[model samples]
Target: MQDITFKHTLPVQLRFNDIDALGHVNNSVYFTFYDLGKARYFEEVKRSPINWNDADLVIANVNANFLSPVFMSESIAVQTATLSIGNKSLKVVQRIINTDTKEVKATCETILVGFDVATSSAKEISVEWKEAISFYEGRELCK
Candidate 1:
């Protein structure tokens, strides 16, 4: 897995609707925080030759494992990391944490496939994308 870490401080306000009568954040709401993290990451990654608005990649699959529940009032943040880079696709690993207590609340991994928009077919992930992700990872090259 090619690992890279990116940080996004998810606001509690964004999760306001997640509070249940039981007084804990709903399990289903974790995905929303993951979505916010990915959005921030895309902004950072697309500042190069890749057109942020015109990218041909889309999420083909995603998986999440909830380790714990978060409370509504707690400060939270979602940290995203790349787990793998493939020929025509990539996978991202995400962790939702309680920033105040430094506790991990959930983990997720998403697979994104690069597609040729015109042909509607899978395409090889560009080297530039790999390089940018690698540099952000601050580790040895992924491939």
Candidate 2:
């Protein structure tokens, strides 16, 4: 895997309950970190208020690979980036890393699709959204 250069990074605080009996952060908790990263990323990129409950996008798929265990004692961060944009969906990649040593603990990629709430169906990626993401990423995205 290539080392990803992330434009956005968010510090993640681990909770005591996040640890399993094995003395490491539970795998499921990482998704929450990624979600925070995604939210922050969008908040910054969109440059406007986002009502998550009324957001027009929905996560279609998520995949992650755990490289190592995360200990509660370590300071951690989640890095996020927009990989590409398609007709109705876009790809986001993220990684959880040890902030002190820069070791990546896990990597994840997700596909988010534009959704119509009232119609209850998929929708085309909005032009406004594409421009916002592309401007923030500093590059033209795939169609």
| Top candidate, metric lDDT | 2
Quantify all predictions' global Cα lDDT against the true fold: 0.74, 0.91
Which runs in model 1 stand beyond 4 Å of their true positions?
Answer: 1-12, 48-53, 140-143
lDDT string, candidate 1, 64-135, tens digits: 888887876778888887776877888888888787787878888999888787787888887877887766
Model 2, C-alpha of 103: deviation from truth (Å): 0.7
Model 1 TM: 0.82
What is the per-residue lDDT of model 2 for residues 53-114, given as tens digits with 9 covering 90 to 100?
Answer: 77888999999999999998999999999889999999999999899999989999999999
lDDT of 1 at 49: 47
Where does candidate 2 clash, by residue pair?
none
Question: How many clashes would you count in candidate 2?
Answer: 0
| Maximum-TM-score candidate | 2
